[model samples]
Target chain A: MSAPRAEAVVIGASAGALEALSAILPALPARFPLPVMVVVHIPPDRRSLLAELFQAKCRVIVMEAEDKEPISPGTVYFAPADYHLLIEHDRTLSLSSDEPVLFSRPSIDVLFESAADAYGDALVAIVLTGANDDGAKGMRAVVEAGGRALVQTPESAFASAMPRAAIDLCPVARVMPLAAIAAYLLEV
Target chain B: MNGDPGSEKVEDIEIRLLLEAIYSQYHYDFRSYAMASIKRRLRQAREHLGFPTFSAMQESLLRDPALLPRLLGYLTVQVSEMFRDPSYFRALREKVVPHLRTYPSLKVWVAGCSTGEELYSLAILFREEGLEERTIFYATDINQDALHAAEAGIFGVDRIPLFTENHRKSGGKSSLSDYYQAAYGRVAFDKTLRRNVVFSDHSLVTDAVFGEMQLISCRNVMIYFDRALQDRALGLFRDSLARKGFLGLGAKESLRFSKHADAFADFVREERIYQRRFE
Candidate 1:
């Protein structure tokens, strides 16, 4: 049997991730059953245009998470700039001012690790284009937690280090180009 | 383990032992912290305390109860600024307070409030909103030292500029400086602003709701907890909020994926303001 119904899709990316995000968001249809959470490495002290930017391209309702606001399907939640976004077990969002991890606060590792803990086998963790190896251990944690893990192929990534690092560290379930990620998400 | 720049084997072992010893000796439960952050904090503690080994750090904490405060300074994340996301306060001023003022009296809880900055900021807001006269504010934290500091209502003068700017941006009515008196490079907040406020030790993870409240602002605290603990805290908040009560979280926090997602509806999504859903 197919694994448990996917509750959420989590993407952890850095560096040139926005390029891939543009391609990935529009791929998921409006009626996509699961919520999508994106963790993009952003500079501290800067505001993010991610929610506004992605909303225009994606069919889903895209909004920045307010504290205590519940997760809903057919919606997209982008990690706030500079804050570590996490999922509480009840699926609420929690943001941290804890010092940056791997020199990044909206760290892929933090999001991926937390999502894995919260959703476990129902999560789909994707690693995308980035310079650092931030998502490696977190992706491993996801796999160990019986969640699905996907990495963007290095050839399709602007900065391949992140996806390659994850590939080296764990046996990812899928490695696809940015164009194929959302398609794969739908098929799965 | 020697000269291996990347292998965390030895470092991890030391951190585990240190955390275990701290828990066994002092009953402080930091054993569940993420390894990387805990490792960094412990390193900072060791260096700050001039201990050559993690064992020395552990010995120092075990020997001197006084050292617990300093160790806590290292372990607890203390990065808070007044009126942190300015517009969140603005939304509170514009949308929430008008409703709050309708009630004859109010009870507000600021959970996971670190170092009193946020608590004081709220006190200022309530005073400006004219709700301070009938409000009872409870500011709770897990760190005793932070609770003590919060009760004292003192802060660095250097922070006043930014806090003042934030207050203004949040649509503050009067001069932000009026809320605190600056003396000799330190600021003591107005005592009257905090007259109805209480600072206490409360752990959202392990503790039950103490009382029902019209408003609860648990900002930036749940980020440290695992999902299970976060859910427990949410349950506490959900249980604690009176019917049609309000909840505020840090800018990045949300209730979307939570079991209680349907329990509250957004009043201002960007500002993270929410009202309890009608049962």
Candidate 2:
């Protein structure tokens, strides 16, 4: 009947994700309470500029996730280019170079599933614009773990396959435009 | 009040018991590893090894002594390459080698040297710097199969081009082709490159310091360890390094938060190279 209280947010995006992220990340004020973990598909061979680029526009702290590093509030952590980012039981960030899932190294499914395990009902997961179905199973896991799942309306997304996949996989909490999703995040 | 019944799943309990069985029976302690990755790997081992669950895997492991290595293969991560992260090697060549050239002799330890790619890279680097004649390299890893592969010094031929490019980017003094001969779709590196190298089975989780060294290049190995295990490995490096000796880690690892952080000073901060400092 009411919105679930969230302690953290997990976001996944692929193609056309940078533009979508740039739109949403700036909407959250500096006093945002929840820690945000993100996995955006990037080329494995090169370094990532997502953290640097996002930090300049977002009011909250933004950085790449590091192994065994603790998660902190008001900070955004992007999964490193080649490593699968996971959340430990102790609520710290960890990175792994295990075999890729769904042909992606920093797989959205991996991050979402792990965050669901660690945060349970206190987690909020978002599936954004992407070209593939990497986040479908992960959003399913979030809903199963008593967490909330939000999908960008497929028609509103630049690349609709990912959000459409999430919508098909799970009965998500909301399907909204990018601006409305950002506004919902602010409410949390 | 001591235990939360809802939070602990049967799968979680079985995994903890499996890790305990592994440590108690085989003396390989993965009990303290970060649980999330461990869980993922164990699930993988379960599915691949044809076991129904972690409990089934543990039962077979405790009864069969021969299953340890196969399970260890699953437990240890073996992803590596020749000149992986070329910038780190470039920094080693341009920044660290100058200091090493001053020493008459050098001992270099490639801790967690998976398949010897890193050891060979350093061996070739020393040879290029004209320090190979005066240096001895200790290449160590926990996986015996990987150690054997390292000693063999052969890699698929397909990997050579990337390795060559990486070598060139690392300020290589000679053609990478000069170091290996290609045959049968594989490249067999020159045995002379390992003339002063010793490949050994060592576990950073349980092993002790074996020798004092002028340099230790242990990149990307600590990412698998928990905070305490990482500290233990860093402590070994601290104790084994000669005063002012250099230590290099994976791009993501840093000593800023380690318990042994005080023993090392940042040498090449951008490259994650640290030098042992004497009090």
Best by DockQ: 2
Candidate 2 local lDDT, B178-244, one digit each (tens):
9999999999999999899999988888888967899999987888888999999999999999989
For candidate 2, give the docking quality class from DockQ: medium
Chain B global fold similarity (TM-score) for predicted model 2 against the true chain B = 0.96
- Model 1 complex DockQ against the native: 0.21
Runs in model 1 deviating more than 4 A are A1-46, A51-79, A85-95, A100-188, B1-20, B31-40, B43-60, B277-279
lDDT of 1 by residue, B234-279 (tens): 8888889988999998777677646777888998897778888888
Per-model fnat list: 0.41, 0.65
| Candidate 1 global TM-score | 0.66
lDDT of 1 by residue, A97-184 (tens): 7768899988888888778867878999999999999999889989998998999998889998999999999865589887788788
Candidate 2, residues A75-180, lDDT tens digits: the string is 9999999899999878899888788999998999999988998898899999999999999999999999999999999998989999999999996557988998
Off by over 4 Å in 2: A1-4, B1-6
